[model samples]
Target chain A: MTLYASSKAALRVYSESLAQELSSQFPGIRVIIVEPSGFRTEQNVLGYPMQIPRNPDPAYDSVREKSMQLYTSLDGRQRGDPEKAVELIVDIVRREGKSVERLGGGRAESPIYVPLGREANNDLEAKCTKMIQVVQKWKDVTDNLDHDDTNSVDLTRWGALRFFFLGSLHAYRAFQDRIRALASAGF
Target chain B: MTLYASSKAALRVYSESLAQELSSQFPGIRVIIVEPSGFRTEQNVLGYPMQIPRNPDPAYDSVREKSMQLYTSLDGRQRGDPEKAVELIVDIVRREGKSVERLGGGRAESPIYVPLGREANNDLEAKCTKMIQVVQKWKDVTDNLDHDDTNSVDLTRWGALRFFFLGSLHAYRAFQDRIRALASAGF
Candidate 1:
């Protein structure tokens, strides 16, 4: 089974659990979870309008403007080269439709500093590569499972859901971290 | 931009609003949505279990068991072929990497209907498919701004939250429909 999710945060949660769940059930089936980083897609730009909750007070106008600027500046630049993203997606889909897990990211990651292309570097391509790696791991683990009895596999009642929720929690934590960083900067 | 979603239901919502919002921003970019059918993957059999709102009760045991039996019957049957399902997903992901929508299904319109390749025709696949189609149509109409342009695109003041609330209403309506069906089934 192959799945594509647009939001890195949302899709990661959905895909990971799905990959894990499928791995346990259909032992030999191929499952791929593709997580494409920010793309210049409508979802990133225009899927949902930035609905401010209230009229910004004059005091907060500058902050609002800055936030809007940060968002709008990403207009067509936040995603990787659209063409390459398409190519990578096609390649993954065409593969034997095996159990695979891949993530598409635009560029390299730097722990201490942001990459040059920032979030837009070959995001989809990188995600695709990671998905491939995940699928390979899944394949390897299950291939060895053949020696073990399927009866021994105690399937979780909702393992997939738990994995998905965990991913969401992780993303939430990441968001919290970013907020903390921004707050610290102000302080 | 191409987009891929895990379910047609998800794609429908993703594409409709996303395309509607960004259509004006990026004229040349193409938005693609893919609706893939159900497949048997590790996750399909088991997903993160939903956090039940309340404690489980013995009274609901029979109901849950019936639901489970209905779901298990459609594993490898008419709902969808896993290989085909993955192939469709990969194709859409590649072709619509910029923007993609996809979905999976198991249950049919009626929970009672059971096909031969039972493994593929589960309840989740069916609902997932229906959900995709419904959401697609729902979002398409909601995003249409021809009726009142003035109220359509404005997101400067509390508009985002207002729209979110409105969307939630629609979702609630959909959920109600599902509940009504279950009620009629004597659940």
Candidate 2:
């Protein structure tokens, strides 16, 4: 679970960066991140009862046992409808049906994130709140370790500019590629 | 930069989970995460003018050039004192020196995080605030995707309980091993 959660977290950050990188010079391109709760898919329901490790350490015995039990119980009880989720995603991408207005039509900026299900929403909301609280609580300690050198260059600003420049270069290359393809096709 | 940032983000999350896992059962075991801003280390000051990639893509030329320039300009100009950062971390860990009062003198809970410098603090605080704002903005979209099953079991709560149980089991095994070793050594 830790591995899975960590990978998902990494993907989330990567997608956000991708979205930011593409939005400026490539207005037609979009990077939408979908956060979905568990759905009652064949894999979730029937792919459990997995083979236990033959030489599992005794220290992890209780956790392993309880995890198996939990997985078994929740096999077919997931509360997400995969079909509806897919349909909504399609609508959002195509900008058709009910999602057209929900996605801000042709004027307002479209959302880069599509968090599906009450579970995803609640979990994300709670996580954000907890993070804000923790940072606020430790503000004093975090603010005291500087080297007393106020004239140093702001590296973060420079880093952001570098990324933005890179993103623009990438977008220009993609645009050139598309134009070349169109020209070859006699457009 | 994307790859490096994503990996660091993954490590942060993994460390947080690890700290939570060990806190309940192993009171003596603590996981401290140190977030350091750029310091004027030998590597930072002297490791510039790195070898350029042999077959670098033309699409990345601009970004690559700008990045090299930025790195050269910032060499030996970082505003962090590495010695001070190390000394403070040691003090915090040993609960000695001026950090004794700063760390609550064995009465209050110890901090699991050590953000060293103004840059780390400001960047983290900004990130947290932005996350909160984004979540709030998209609250409506996230809340509307439920499957209308109010009677579904709360899986997040169950997952938390499982981890806690696992942590306890691990702690018990560790305690038993310690006792056995002590007995054999005539302690």
Candidate 3:
């Protein structure tokens, strides 16, 4: 589960970066991330048979049992209609039917993400909310993690020189500001 | 850069999950994620050379040039002290020196993450802030993505049965609530 979840997360981030990277050079190119929840596919319905692992570790027994039960029970009972999902996806891509209205009649930019079901939407929203909450909770500690003398005049010349020479345009500008500040302070 | 960044993200998430998974069974075990920025190691200082690709594409020429210039200039001038970073990491893991006070005299739990430099802290904070801003911007759309008839009585018996039989404990509770609601509605 951990591996699967992490891989999915990596794919999601990669897609997002791809979308951003392509947007400036290729405005016509659209990268839409479709997150579907429990479509009634053959795999979801009957492919997941309960099979105990031959060398299952004792520590993971409970989790294994629970997951097995869950998958077996959910088989063939998923709420999502695969055919309807396909139709909607096609419509979204072609800008037809109700999707045209939802997409603002080809005037507005399409959303980067389109969660296809109630479960998908809820799960995504929950994850986002949880992330926000965790970050907020640790905001103070995270903000204060910098070295104490980050802005001190005692910053080494090598440090300043590196920024001036090798840094991006933004870093160069910042280095210039730092130099100006140091000069004003008679350093 | 995208691949590297996404892989790092995946590793971070995987480590986080590992920490959570092991916490219950292994109370004595600690998982520490150290994010260091621009340490004056050989790699940061002199390892990167400005090497042009043999078959460079014209489209990426600008970016390639900029990155090369940036890296070459920054060589040997990175601000972080590798020795100091190592010392700090050791102190944190050993619960010694100033870390004792910072960690509350060995009574409080150690932080799961230890960002090592000013740049790392600022970048992490910025990332978190940006994430919060993006999620907030799309809150309405995300919250409203559920199927219109999510709570309708038309939900198939198979769907309810799946939840009752195979779902997790939380899902089971949610199903019970839905069933009660349906019963009250004279379904």
Top candidate on TM-score is 2
Ranking of all predicted structures according to lDDT, beginning with the best and ending with the worst: 2, 3, 1
lDDT (Cα, tens digit) per residue for candidate 2, span B1-187: 5554566667767776676556655667777776666554434322345433433656556655766776566555656655566566667777877556555645434226766556666666676666556556556665564457664555676753223222222223333454465569795
Q: If both were scored by lDDT, which would come out higher, candidate 1 or candidate 3? A: 3
TM-score of each prediction: 0.26, 0.73, 0.61
Individual DockQ of the candidates?
Answer: 0.02, 0.15, 0.12
Candidate 1 per-residue lDDT, tens place, B1-187, comes to 0111233224434554555444445544445432212323323233323222232756545435543543354222212233333333334334443112221132111101111121212222442343344333323222221222132222223233213322222222333454465569785
Residue A84 local lDDT, model 2: 60
Clashing pairs for model 3 are A45-A76
Q: Residue A113 lDDT in model 3?
A: 62
Estimate, for each residue in B41-102, the C-alpha lDDT of model 3 and write its tens digit. Answer: 34432234546453365766765676566566555555555545555555767777645655
Once superposed on the true structure, which residue ranges of model 2 sit more than 4 Å away at CA? A20-27, A50-55, A96-111, A159-187, B50-55, B96-111, B149-151, B159-187
Tens digit per residue, CA lDDT, model 3, A1-187: 5565567667766786677557656778888766655544345322346464633567778756765665665555555555455555556677886466556645345235666555555454554555445444444444343334443222233343223212222232333454466569795
TM-score order of candidates, top first: 2, 3, 1
